[model samples]
Target: MNPLRILLLCHSFNSLSQRLFAELRAHGHTLSVELDIADSVTEEAVALFRPDLVLAPFLKRRIPPTVWQRVTCLVVHPGPPGDQGPSALDWAVWRGEPHWGVTVLQANGDFDAGPVWAHASFDMRPATKGSLYRREVTQAAWRATLAAVQRFAGGERSAPALPDDAPLVRWQPLLRQSERAIHWATESTTSVLAKLRSGDGQPGVLDTLWGQACYLGDAHPASAAAMAEFSDAEPGAMLAVREGALLRCTVDGGVWIGQARRADPPDTHPTQRSFKQVAAELFATEAAGLPQRPVPLQRSPDEWGELRYTEHGPEGARVGCLGFDFYNGAMSTARCERLRAALLQVRERPTKVLLLLGGEGFFSNGIDLNSIEAAAHRPGDSAADASWRNIQAMNDVALAVLQTTDRLTVSVLRGNAGAGGAFLALAADQVWAHGSVVLNPHYKNMGNLYGSEYWTYLLPRRLGDAGAKALMTQRLPLLAAEALKIGLLDHNDEGSRQGFEERSLERALALASSYNQSGELAAKQARREQDEAHRPLALYREQELARMHRNFYGFDPSYHVARHHFVHKQPHAWTPRHLAVHRP
Candidate 1:
């Protein structure tokens, strides 16, 4: 099929949109992005870009008839054929549907009732709505969208009619907070989990904790042993606090509620209405009264945690795998400190190689903006101070990675990475990622943040001066294959997420047992010494932090303003010029 001009219309350039953009561009399509700001603005974009097709990967509003009638428009609905709704995933998850899918259909007067162009389905997994959408929904949507786009590119304008058995009007209304409310006293652990998972990451299950109204989410089932210990506790009773989560007993078992947002009164200012934060932090006073239950850094698979360490292979050739699965890959000051401590501890192990497998769905996304925003409300803390502390903690983690010269350190990106996280990967001797991983290596999008994860020292060495400068300004997502073609990635493998994990482990073991492992380590040490002599790492850090200090404490409020909007989930007023190519 000949490549065609495509305009991506989305509510926000979310993960799905970024993946579509990267994949479509890789297929040689001329693409532009226009946020679904307003009907008139979208019409103007259609006039300017004159795209052959408009692909709506993620949108809350329907496309205007004036634009869809003039050009072929494909709406990527996150549902199977005949499923029409704004909250398809939420409903599917809440009901524990065995299967779900993505459908590519032509834009029509009725929402999600258009002629089906393509559809792809996947067996449902027990996970949060956000997790399902990021993984299964994204992959299925890409496949279906690609097929639909190909059909259009091949001059197939007409879509086949829907089956006669199809419902004439199967519209599932948006799932409301009332539907997601949890009944702690009556519901079992599994039931409570379903309610929380369905609303995880947005409009979390509205509930009262410690007599204060709040939205609950990021729940995990307590271990069987832990639940057994709390079996006698009254249902709905807060049992304990562990790793920043609150464990509450259920009728059958117990669950750890990891995150929450305060449901402030309507009279409260929007800015003061809390965004999601660690549940323990959100209700710090109450959590303090509960007993603290800390788990070992290495534990059973049934246990839940943000960080875990495991050793592979025998004695001398052993490989250490440290996985840090932070929620949404947001590293607050505390998380960074925890990660740094884990890195240091893992280094002490008698292992020749260390694998840093960062989270599912995201490797890391730099400093936690939400945490910093919440800091503003704390009694003695300010956002600026919190930002400084978080960045420094992040820098400390990167530095620890850089200093691990004795072992062969590998940063395996099992998921997407952006901003300082991208550079943090470079701190390792080699960076590996699967083909599906997307990397946003620049931090300008977060209010022109001059990032400080030793990127000045790490990036320039990887891509040289000019290439590094160019990448810092590109402000675009780079696919793993393209990253390998350039110097951004050392290795890229094509495989499913599970396959990638297996292969990455195999590769890491191979590196650990390499014939010239000692020689490679020596060479690495020598180069580090030479680089240190040429320009101290501290100098690079100092220079980077100088610029970052301005971003955090300087006159320009762009970083703070952007952070507030992002944490608050504010709707976009206009598309960024970099994304909306039709704009001046």
Candidate 2:
């Protein structure tokens, strides 16, 4: 089939849009993106690009009839056929539906009532609406959208008739906060969790923190041990604080609230109104009064914490697992320092191989933009200072990983990774990822950031100087298979998260027990020594930090401006030229 020119219309270039952009382009499609700023803007885009079809991967608004009538428009809905309206995933998650789907429909006069080009379904899991969308919803949407695009490329203009069971699915209205209210007196942990997660990463559950109106999110179930001491506390009482999350007692047990946003700020600071901050920071005074509950680094599996260490296999052939599950995978300066300490601690263990298992939804997206933006409002702190500190702390973490020469180390990515996090993974002896993973290895997208996780040295070593330069300039996402083919990843395992974990452990065990394990370790140390002799690691650090320091404190305010708009969720005025292929 001949390749077609496609225009992507989206509210923002979110995860789904980015994934689609990468995959469709890989399939030989000439694509351009136009942000859904206004009907006039979209129409102008269609007129200028004159694409054969317009694909709306993620949009919150209806397509302009003028454009749709002029050309074919495909809208990807996060719902099954016959299901309509916004908040489809919200209602599904809140209701605990066992199965859900994605439908690709042709645009028409009515919303979500268009011809069904394609549809796909998957079993749902207990997770936040954002998490579900990022994983299952994204995978299903990709498949269905690709199928629809294929059909269109084959000259199929008309959609097939709806299935016999299409009538079974019904439209669901927007999920309101009142319907998601938590009855602290009667609701169990499970129900409360459902309500909190349903609207997570968006309009969170409308609630209060110490009688202050706010939105609550990033919740985790409190461990049994944490709840045992709080049994006498009232259902709504604040129990303890750990790792920037507040433990609030539920009727049956307790739940950890990780983040919150003030519903009614003084209108003085937009950060308060725009982004969610770590709950402990939001309620610092109140949280200070609560008891501190610290758990061991090697806690039980059922326990909840950002950092955890576990060991397996016999003493001589032991394999250590160092896991850091930061919320949403944004590593603030504090988090990076904590992870650095944890890495150093794990290195002391008598293990032959170590696995760096990052968080579930994201390995890391680099420094926390929200926190840096929030710093602008503080009295003595500035975003530049925070950026500098955070990047330095991240460098510390990377240095710790790079300096560990006694044992073999592998960076295992079970989810998406971007920016410095992608390079940080390169600090390991080997990098492995699940097939579903997407990696945005370059940092230029974040306001042309000159990234500083020693990427200057790390990337060139992996891809050579010319290849590294090409990749950095590309500014695109890389799928796991493509990454491996390009030598960015050493292994690409295909499976669910659970299956990936099991398979990775098996591989790590094999490496730990291999007869040539000692030889491999010695070879790795020798190579590191050779590289250091050619150019000291400190020299690389100095050069990278020099550029990064300018990014943080330099005269150009692009980085700060971009970060502010990003953390505040500002609408895009126009699409980036790199993504707007039709431009120029």
TM-scores of the candidates in the order shown: 0.98, 0.97
Put down candidate 1 lDDT per residue, 131-159, tens digits, no spaces.
88888898899999999988889999977
Lowest-scoring 10 consecutive residues by lDDT in candidate 1? 160-169
RMSD per candidate (Å) reads 1.5, 1.6
| Per-residue lDDT of 485 in model 2 | 91
Off by over 4 Å in 1: 161-169, 267-272
Error of 2 at 249 (Å): 0.7
Please give me the total number of clashing residue pairs in predicted model 2: 0
lDDT assessment of candidate 2: 0.90
TM-score of 1: 0.98
Give the lDDT of residue 29 in candidate 1: 97
Which residue pairs come into collision in candidate 2?
none
